[model samples]
Target: MEVSKKNKLNKIVKEIETCQACNLCKNRIKSVVSRGNENAKIILIGEAPGKLENEIGKPFVGKSGQQLNDLLSKVGFNPEQDIYFCNVVKCRPVRNNKDRKPNKQEIEACVKYLNAQIEIVKPEIIILCGNTAKKIFKINKPLKMVHGSCIDYKGIKLIPVYHPRASIIDEVKFNDLKKVKKLRG
Candidate 1:
């Protein structure tokens, strides 16, 4: 229906929760639509939900999420005030082997929701975290090779960065997150 701009956010979220738009819906415990200030200038797009996020019905709530919070704080971004967080896919793409990566079908299936979130949030800049996000945007370059650079995505400025979980394994990359604050300025 004709959801007004005021109610669009909540309405879209509710619709997503009930969405059978894709096969991912069948296994979803909850749809991780998005979180943070609706009016924020920047949106942080993650890959997908992990176990903690799925359980809490929130985006970025796991250990990686905590690291992400610290990184944001280092860059002076307060999620409640300055940033929006979402995933390219609303549900965690399942892997029977637990090591299998999310396949193209899963990514393609959920793209509509991701696009809708972007359309609704309408942020000035999008901080794309990790390879999944980069690939969705069609940037095939390695993350380390392209992180911190800004590129246009259908009129929005997209900045690619490492996923917070990556930092848990590499640690050195944590220092590079300072660049996020520059987008605020």
Candidate 2:
């Protein structure tokens, strides 16, 4: 990455850390930022941070994270070197009952940061790993309908896939990831 780009990303991360754009920030323990190579060719975007991710201020560090990691290995991608992991909402959206999906307002508030990351990374492929991510990308179809298929959005290839935590875990999702690898190449 260029020095200027690195500096710009740092500036964005700082802004995210201190942002008070929505109510999600009010209860967050830490603002979960991105992890992995800044020059990564593939970016994996999830919906929001879960409990463990919130505690660590890192995206994809929970059970779902483990699943993702395994999937990456199976597809011959390196998390630390080839892919940048992030979430649509940087903070955990907790409610009275349990950690819940980020509401529309919260998603709206945090999307700018995600957009900034996309611009900075300029990834060749962006994996929208769940419904919320697909929604943000304006992909109206169900994940099952489009998962593994790459859609050209602007110039980037957007691949919708099932969230790692989704109830159904199967080889089809793994196949989808393999498709991602092929597309990345």
Candidate 3:
């Protein structure tokens, strides 16, 4: 099962590597596919790649990723072994040569890849790490208001949380992360 899952994920990685469906394809140094364990039952979704991620071609590998790693550790989860890290938009969203939120068109174009990742991984829990990630699930509300509640996404637990860059872990986010430790296994 793990081998098939890994094979399917590898195909998706190749597909993402050559994606030219959006304008981001023009400026991106590399298309950030995903990172961490493919067999993980948990998926951590961020908004898009940052500068480091764009350069390295992996999601959640910047300073923010380190912070997220610490948080995951505090919550009793191992990022390398338990979480499948990805982003809503694969390429780094940029404006004025600085990282920026992905626009609607970009999100729409790359959403198929995100959807495919989810389908292949079939994770039991999805942690939406910021508003952009959360909004893709059609929950149009502020992260402050919705963070930490587990909404059902096709039988999977969908959790909205502040971005690691924001460093804002509310009570709900903390408890939710802590509570899911048992499920990580």
Which candidate leads in lDDT?
Answer: 2
Q: Give each prediction's root-mean-square deviation over alpha carbons.
A: 2.6, 1.5, 2.1
Structure candidate 1, residue pairs in collision: none
Q: Locate the minimum summed-lDDT window of 10 residues in model 2.
A: 1-10
Tell me how far the alpha carbon of residue 114 in candidate 3 is from the true structure, in angstroms, after superposition.
0.5
Q: Candidate 1 lDDT, tens digit per residue, 58-158?
A: 89988988878887877667767898888888876667724234678888877887887778878889888889988988999998788888888888888
Per-model CA lDDT versus the true structure:
0.78, 0.89, 0.86
**Candidate 1, TM-score vs. the true structure?**
0.88
Clashes counted in candidate 1 amount to 0
Per-residue C-alpha lDDT of model 3 across residues 1-185, encoded as one tens digit per residue: 35597888889888877889999987688889899998899999999998999999999899988878887898888789999999999998888989999999999999999999999989999998889999999999887788777799889999888887775544555665776675554
Task: Flag the better candidate by TM-score, 1 or 3.
Answer: 3
Off by over 4 Å in 2: none
**Candidate 2 residue-wise lDDT, 1-185, digit = tens:** 45676788889889988899998888688889798888898899998888888889899888889899999998999888999989999989988837799999999999999999999899999999999999998899888799999999889999999998877666978999999999877
Per TM-score, what order, best first? 2, 3, 1
